[model samples]
Target: MLILWTQGDTNGIGSEVILKSFHRWRHRPHRAVVVGSYCMMKFYEKRLNLTTPLVEIESLNDIPMQEKTPDEPLYVLSLSCNIKANVGEIQADAGELSMKAVERAATLCLSGEADAMVTAPIHKEAIAKAGYPFQGHTDFLEHLSQSGRAQMLLCDIETNLKVALATVHIPLGKVSETLRASGLRPHLTALANALTKNFGIQTPRLAVLGLNPHASDNGVIGKEETEFLQPELALLKQDFCVDGLFAADGFFGAKRYKEFDAVLALYHDQGLIPFKMLAFETGVNMTTGLPIVRTSPDHGTAFDIAGKGIANEASFLSATHLAIQVAERRRHLETTA
Candidate 1:
């Protein structure tokens, strides 16, 4: 249950959310550690007036392999980033710091030093400026884990909603072509696998949303559903209980989303906008089809609210809880299998 929490951008609310999360817990519930700048955490501790048992360690070897105490405190990996402690402004150094922390933490998970990972939000612009040019945490994780075809799954336990995106962090103009070129099979496969394994759904049924209005009205609006999706749907139906390139707005508006185990949205905004609308402060972002378990808060860096001591930690806390559950389930499944 050694969860490594990566400190995201120093310019945003990553550190604050993390600290605030620990503060909200009456008693520590998970064995978690941080993999980020020690100085930055200290600065936030002062600014946010939050305190936790922070055991700063140079490496994983410093930790004892035993059950953690209820008040075991949050251990930090303690990498020096020379953080400026500047809140609410993006910087190249903060970007580098965030990337370094994530890469190091992911390395631990890949190497079996950690059981699961909960990443704080990282700024795409800052990370790009720092020379780690990737779309976001998901892409960076794909590279680090060498896990091909990573899928982004967002969930809200309270709302009982799960959305898996086909294409993330891409322009709206390119979404159609991207989904068309990639085909729906991979997205379908990944979503189905995660639902079965992580969520323990024996026969998960999924709702597939269209890339066009009215699901293209049988090719009147767009051919993506007929030309690309139909063929794959024909093949996937043999193994999965999936149906529809349902029209997005109507499906969500009618609350048909609740009828399925999950929904597949063709693009980032398509999936996230509705998901966030329903569960803005409680959703968790999970990456499936990876060698290691990874989950994150649904929100971004939140620079506008950084250092205000008012950023909600519920989403980040939910992410941590889900990571622990998924990790345990994964281990149990491996043993049982």
Candidate 2:
């Protein structure tokens, strides 16, 4: 398997975490390449005093066509841009380079040049400053892949806790209207298919978190649960083994997430707040419903500790492992089919 990792932001801890994760993995079973500026990677390697050998390749075709060893040098498919790294600062040039890396990685994956992609943390504000209209990687990748719909799935490898968001990177004020307009059936169907195809769950048992406080307290607080959610869930039961509209607080507090194969949260924070609290170091964010495999560390660009050599790579490692697992599973299913 070959994985293409995108250099998130030259000004953030993206380079630090990528270098550290590769260094820590002594016995490599797969080939990995970084898609970004070679100069930026070299700068981090020297500044952090790491011994990982960096090799710059002209294109994806230049990658060595053989099994990689435990001590294999990291290959970088350097982009055309020449952005300088300014640690702990947000620069438009850095943002432009990071997004360019992402775009190239997506193209490689869709073209079958790469098996999977693992993205580093990218700053939302920086990308905006760069004049891109994307809110985050999920939407940007969706546009690149031209997928029907993209959903964000956060997973914890240690505990097998997986949560998928129905609505992502949207304002809280528009969540209700968006849900009503788009409907929940498509998101639920997509989540179920992703579990079966990506994670290899034969018959996934799923749960959903409510959009209202206390699940609307039986319509005492809000009508979303009774008016919209319940009706959709009732109709969806015939096609899926899903139960939900559970109050977010009690469901997670009581450890009910373990009972289901995966939980679907209506909005972003409804799922991420609890997920980050439980698996801050091990969380892996994956984009489902895309034609190609994609995963990233759940955390963001830590500018405060960008150049301090203290950023943890646990989550990035987890994301790498998950990407490999999913890619292999998809390949297996393809061959069998």
Model number with the top TM-score:
2
TM-score of 1: 0.95
TM-score of each predicted structure versus truth: 0.95, 0.98
- Tens digits of per-residue lDDT for model 1, 135-206: 888988999999887889999988889999999988888988887678888888899899988989988999
Cα lDDT listed for each candidate: 0.88, 0.92
Q: What would the per-residue lDDT of candidate 2 be over residues 1-337, giving only the tens digit for each residue?
A: 9999898998888999999988876477888899998899999999989768999998988877777888788999999546777899988888888999999999999999899999998989999999999998999999999998898999999989999998888899999999899888998889999999998798899999999999998899888888888898999899899998899999999999999999999998999999999999999999999999999999999999998899999999999999999999999989999
Estimate the lDDT of model 2. 0.92
Indicate the residue-level lDDT of 197 in model 1.
88
* Candidate 1, lDDT over the whole model: 0.88
Off by over 4 Å in 1: 64-66
CA lDDT, candidate 2, residue 60: 80
